[model samples]
Target: MSGSVNMDMFGTPLQKLFSLMQLTLVIAGLMGLVLLLWLLFRALMPKKGQTKRGRKGK
Candidate 1:
C-alpha cells in the first residue's frame, strides 16, 4: 500500500540513528577500559629509582 511505502522510508532514519548510537557506545566503553587498565598499572608499579636494576639503566 501507499501508506506502507511512506512508513518504510521514514524508518530508515531511525535505523541509522540507532546504528550510530551503538557504535558510539562501543567505542566509549573500550576507551574507558583502556584508561582504567593504565591507571591500575601505574598504581601497582614501583616508583622511580626504587629498584637496584633501574639505577643501572639496562
Candidate 2:
C-alpha cells in the first residue's frame, strides 16, 4: 500500500503571521543592543579641546 502526505496544513496564513512576528522581534532586539553599546561608549569616552574653552589667546 502507498501512503500520500498532505502539506496543506502548514501553508496557512497563521504561519506567515507567526514568521513575520519572529523577524520583527529579532530586529528590535538587535537595535536595542546597538543603542546600549553606543551609550556605554559615549559615557566612557573623554571630551576634546576641554582646556581651550575658557581661556583666550594671549
Candidate 3:
C-alpha cells in the first residue's frame, strides 16, 4: 500500500460538532425511553392491601 493517507477522513470542525450533537441526542433519547418504561412499570404494579379498621393485634 502507498504511504499517503487521506486527510479528508479526519473531517472538518463543523462535521465533528454535528456528530457530537447527534451522539448527545441519541443518549438523551435512550434515557427518556428508560424513564418512560420505569413509569409504566410502576403504574401497572398492584398496590399492597391494607386493613381499614387498624392493626389486627389491637
Candidate 4:
C-alpha cells in the first residue's frame, strides 16, 4: 500500500497550473459580481421610457 500512488508532475508545472486556476477563479468571480450588480441596478431603478420592443399593449 505504500508504493501504490504515483504522480508525474512535480514542481514548475504544478505551480503554473495552480496560478492559472487562481487567475481563472478571480476572473470568473469578478464577472459574476459585475453581472449581479447590473441585474440589481436594472431591477431597482425605475424605467425612463417605453421600450421600442414592447409588445404588451400594442
Candidate 5:
C-alpha cells in the first residue's frame, strides 16, 4: 500500500497537534488562575470560628 497520511480530527496531523497543544495550555492557565484566586480569597477572609473582638456585644 502507498504511503497515505490520514487526516486527523483537526484536519491534518500538524493542525491536530497544534490544536491539542493550545487546548492543553488554555486549560492549564485557567486552572492556575482559579487556584490563585482561591488562595487570595482564603488569605483575605477570616476563619469561621473566629470573630472580631469588639463586635461580640453588638
Candidate 6:
C-alpha cells in the first residue's frame, strides 16, 4: 500500500490542530489583556490608606 500517513493528516487532523492553536492564542491574548489591565490599575490607584504622593507634592 506504500503506506502514507502524511496524506491522511492533511484533512481533518490539520484543521483540528489549527483550530486548537487559534483557540490557545485567543485565550492567551485575553489573559494578557486582563493582566495588563490589572497592572495598570495597580500602578494608577493608591494602596490602602495611602494617598497619591505626586498629587500631594504638586
Evaluate residue 10 in candidate 2 and report its C-alpha lDDT on the 0 to 100 scale: 49
Per residue, candidate 4 scores C-alpha lDDT tens digits across 1-58 of 3233213323468766876798899999999999999997677553635544444533
lDDT of 6 at 56: 44
Regions more than 4 Å wrong, model 4: 1-11, 49-58
Q: Write the per-residue lDDT of candidate 3 for residues 1-58, one digit (tens) a residue.
A: 2222223323567666776798899999999999999897556543434434334423
lDDT (10s digit) by residue, model 2, range 6-47: 233246667667767888999999999999999975665445
Candidate maximizing lDDT: 1
Q: Is 1 or 6 the stronger prediction by lDDT?
A: 1
lDDT of 6 by residue, 1-58 (tens): 3235444545568766886798899999999999999998778765645656545452
Ranking by lDDT: 1, 6, 5, 4, 3, 2
Residue pairs in clash, model 4: none
Q: How high is the CA lDDT of each candidate model?
A: 0.75, 0.63, 0.63, 0.66, 0.69, 0.72
State every prediction's TM-score relative to the real structure: 0.60, 0.58, 0.60, 0.59, 0.59, 0.60
* lDDT-best of 1 and 2: 1
Clashes of each: 0, 0, 0, 0, 0, 0
- Model 1 steric clash pairs: none
Q: Model 5: per-residue lDDT, tens digit, 1-58?
A: 2234234443677867887898999999999999999997667556745545435343
- What TM-score does prediction 3 earn? 0.60
What is the per-residue lDDT of model 1 for residues 1-58, given as tens digits with 9 covering 90 to 100?
9687557756899866776798899999999999999997666556654654454453
Compute the lDDT of residue 50 as modeled in candidate 2. Answer: 47
Comparing 4 and 5 on lDDT, the stronger one: 5
In model 4, how large is the Cα lDDT of residue 51? 46
